[model samples]
Target: MHPMLNIAVRAARAAGNLIARNIGQQDTFEVATKNKDDLVTSIDKQCEKVIVDTLLKSFRDHGIIAEEGGVQGNPDSEYQWIIDPIDGTTNFVQGIPHCAVSIALRHNGKTEIGVVFDPMANEMFTAARGSGAFLNGRRIRVGSRDSLDGAIIGTAFPTRYRDRMHAYLELFSRLISNCADVRRMGAASLDLCYVACGRFDGYLEQGLKAWDFSAGDLILREAGGIVTDFMGEPNYVKSGNVVSGNPKVLRALLQVCDVQNLPAILK
Candidate 1:
């Protein structure tokens, strides 16, 4: 295993364990509403602390950009750790058992290590720059499904940005018309990893944060999948509007998005 990736796995697993222990115990912690729909529990902070502390222990100079906790460490540092301590906070708080611990290491602004651990399932999805993606200790790859017909796609609605919901529904309608079906699972990190391991043929979403997709982005690419913005560009990380799948499926999805004449704001 890559050294940095090893640390990432450790951090993710530690946070995952913390999350697992506290699942369904919402009464034990406080929940804060970040917005009309987003919820952050005190466990999120505790998990973030565990992950950040674990990482900083090995690389004290590395910077951090997290969900509950904002940017920390020196902004000028070449190495940055992006994290979503609880990728499915709502699910976790509701005892849905679908959340994950996401951690990624970016060197000079390029993500080189990714780890998304589902504590409930004890599944660890990991990847390094050149190494292939993995679940547990075995390598994994994206599904070979090349077409949208009969494809099982995953997605999350832009609930936080309701202004884009209309365009989102349009895209969803078009996709369902040609594909098998669509799933709106709440966890973006696991949704991307599902695509990486063939459980989901593809996925799309908007208004996500860097912490949400940074780790899964690297994992999917390492597993032979592709990710891009709605415009089929490399700006998904910046735009937070991502479409991902194996090569052929990705092109097909882009085609569906193209005809929508989606508002420029979405791209």
Candidate 2:
């Protein structure tokens, strides 16, 4: 593993452990509403602190962008860590056991290290640039399903952005008709990891922040999958719109989703 990636794994595991210990203790923590359907808890803040602290111990000058805490450290640094301390805060609060701690390191503006740790399952999904993706230290890859007929597709609700609901529904309706089935697991990072591990052939969602998908996106790509914006461009990180899967499935999904014309509606 790359040195930075190793540190990322360590930080993610530490944060995940903190979250795991706090699961089912929602009543003990203060929950803040980010929006109508978005939430944050004390656990999220604490976990982010744990991750940021762990990384700074190894590289004090590196930048940090966390979901709960926002930006910290040297923003102008060539290295930046993007973190989602608890990727599925709502799920964690509801005792769903499907949340995860996601951490990614970008060097010179490109993601080079990715780690997503699911504490409940003790599954660590990781990938370093040029290194293949892994699940629990075992190499993993995208599913071989060439089409959507029998493929399981993963997605999440665009609850935070109701204005995009119409566009999402149009895409969802199309997917429901073409794919074998669809799942909304409430965790974008885990959904992307699932696609990497062959549990789901493809995944898509909108209204996500960089932290929500940065780590998982790299893992999926390293697992032999393609990730792109709705227009099949490498702008998902900035656009917050993602469509990812194996080559064939991704192409088919793009066609069905009609993502080429999504920018207008999405905006």
Among all windows of ten consecutive residues in candidate 2, which has the lowest summed lDDT?
A: 258-267
Q: Would you give me the overall lDDT of model 1?
A: 0.91
lDDT tens digits, residue span 138-159, model 2: 9999999989999999987677
Q: Could you give me the TM-score of model 1 versus the true structure?
A: 0.97
**By how many angstroms RMSD does model 2 differ from the true structure?**
1.3
Model number with the top TM-score:
1
Number of clashes found in candidate 2: 0
lDDT of 2 at 68: 80
lDDT of each: 0.91, 0.90
Kindly list the per-residue Cα lDDT of model 1 for residues 101-217, writing each as its tens digit: 999989988999999999999999999998889999899999999899999999887888888778778878888998999998899999999999999999988888899999999
> What overall lDDT, based on C-alpha atoms, would model 2 receive against the true structure?
0.90
